[model samples]
Target: METAVKTTWKIDTAHSEIAFKVKHMMISTVTGYFEDYNAEVNTTKEDFSDAEFSFTAQTASINTKNADRDAHLKSDDFFNTKTYPEMKFTSTSFDGTTLVGDLTIRDVTKKISLEVDFNGVVVDPYGQTKAGFEISGELNRKDFNLTWSAVTEAGKIVVSDKVKLQLNLQFIKS
Candidate 1:
């Protein structure tokens, strides 16, 4: 648990979750999660300032708990998984809390900042050094070229353009 030099940590996928919530039918919220993804963190300081992070999520593995809807999401109407199969993020700065990074979706890459809450580090009962983090951000789906939309009979948008991203991450020292 001591940081004498730079340390590397790998995300514990089994204990971490990456999810998004979007407004549905202009009335309700629908939540979805990525089943496949990985991330790595490297740091030179215990406070985590200047830490480096990289993440990748498999587009085809997205799930909204509905198969038909999930298929439609994988089509060109949404993420266009056939054309761009993965979304990636690479951190440019981490000031111990706020993290600025480049997020690439489809074929477009844009800089984004996410608020990070570090939940401290602990040595688990298994004797592994672990850290927990809660990260949240919002992004306009249209900016990533996910411009598909529809209006219902009552004139409500089927899907909202704003997507809220939430991540609960656990990392184990490596």
Candidate 2:
């Protein structure tokens, strides 16, 4: 039997981003990001099959441009950062494409899958090996207990249950 030794990679935060978009009032989209996050990637070969991925984002680092709105998201009605200070994901499988993992938010954990596109690997001028990926998925906020919502007099929903997540990640071999 052939055995493959996995290589570990560290996330290059300066070159990576974790962002999301949610519909507001069933109209425009509100974009946001987690200012602080980290991830680990382990792979047997460049193809990235039999890979392991894990990530965590500081709940308090959530930013939505509007300070008030950001604060509200961190409150008890939403993430309740004080109680659940971090969101996390651990991959169960990756076939060089789809990624299946367990996502935890506000102490609630659920199995979720994200579509992934590998952008190839490169060697930087500094001789650092790096890899890139664009990943996206949609999840219901309510599933993670982010049940806060409001309704206008016109009967419009203030916040939609579904949230769209986008991640542009770059990792450096460690």
Candidate 3:
């Protein structure tokens, strides 16, 4: 009988971040993050092609350095954290550096693909094995039911409908 080996990884939050950017005022881009999230990866060796991954983010933890703006985002006009407090992702397939998964947000589930670059693995000075990844993907907010906008007096939508996501994750083998 052949025994299968799997490696598990726990996200290092202090060294990981999830962020997004969107066009604002049709002139500049606004960026922000959830500030709190958790992720895990299970794989054979270091090949993501054989990996299973999942991540969860607290919707109410969004932070843009502005309390008022953050509060507004958590209101019913946006994430409506009281109703849907968590956003989640689970991978369904991995092809080389690309990951296909289902992302759930605001009670809507959408299939999304991410282009990932495995930054290879390293052995830290503390004698721990770790891996680093820089992954990015974009999804239309409308598809996830995040549609909320206002037309400005200048005729521009107060908010853009498209949101771009970027994730930087560092994981320690467990």
User: Number of the top candidate by TM-score?
Assistant: 2
Give each model a TM-score. 0.96, 0.98, 0.96
Q: Sort by lDDT, best first: what order?
A: 2, 1, 3
Clashes found in each candidate (C-alpha, N, C closer than 3 A): 0, 0, 0
lDDT of 2 by residue, 33-134 (tens): 999999999999878877899999999999999999999999999989999999999999899899999999987999999999999899999999999999
Which regions of candidate 2 deviate over 4 angstroms? Answer: none
Please write out the lDDT profile of model 1 over residues 76-130, one tens digit for every residue. Answer: 9888998899999999989988999999999999999999999988999999999
RMSD of each: 2.4, 0.9, 1.0
Better of 1 and 2 by TM-score: 2
TM-score of candidate 3 against the unseen true structure: 0.96
Model 1 RMSD, rounded to 1 decimal: 2.4
Q: How far does residue 73 in candidate 3 sit from its true spot (Å)?
A: 0.9
Per-residue lDDT, model 1, residue 36, is: 94
Candidate with the larger lDDT of 2 and 3: 2
